[model samples]
Target: MISGRRQKKLGVRTLDIAKRLLDYGFHPPTIYFPLNVEECMMIEPTETESKETLDEFIEAMIQIAKEAEENPEIVQEAPHTTVVKRLDETKAARKPVLRYRKREAQKQ
Candidate 1:
């Protein structure tokens, strides 16, 4: 297990990533993501030095960040995962839909 300043340095990376993602239109990759309390963006690169796994995951994460910066289409298309994805969530968020299409018009 990585201890001391290294771990602390790594720990702050979550925030760093979030702040960096701000440049893009989307929010910081969902701050404390997943809603599982501590089960968030706590990637322990120090814990794993398997080279391939580390390189691959880190590289992908980097590419995701870059993609977020350059073309957000990739980030938005993060598919084949769970229920929260693969749909136009914005459409579901329309309050008119929530209120059964009761638009504020013609009502006296």
Candidate 2:
């Protein structure tokens, strides 16, 4: 349970960290809920994960912290190695393109 406020000035956003985690082949933890804490990240390792796996996750988090300090932009724009890039959530919600239509269909 690590809250991101400790390094907020460095532009360390919880969403950015979560996105970066995807690059390391791990799912992002639940973030920014339970309003008592700001930019909260709850990482609960289940019994299914071995010790080595937990260690790997810790190492990845450390690396991400370093990257955030040295190259903040990288952390800000995460998921660089993924197939699809980030999306504008507000825009998507406001103007959603749910289905596709051919040009001929529109003309008819």
Compose the digit string of candidate 2's lDDT tens values, residues 1-108.
788775467987988999999999899999987678888999989999999999999999999988989998888898888998988879989999798668996888
Clashes of each: 0, 0
Off by over 4 Å in 2: 99-108
Q: What TM-score would you give candidate 1 relative to the actual structure?
A: 0.37
**Taking the tens digit of each residue's C-alpha lDDT, what string does model 1 give over 1-108?**
111122123343344444433333223344445455442464444564688866665565676556555665545455423334444546756643533555579554
Judged by whole-model lDDT over C-alpha atoms, candidate 2 comes out at 0.88
Tell me each candidate's TM-score: 0.37, 0.84
- Residue 43, model 2: lDDT of 94
Q: Ten consecutive residues with minimal summed lDDT in candidate 1?
A: 1-10
Best of the candidates, lDDT: 2
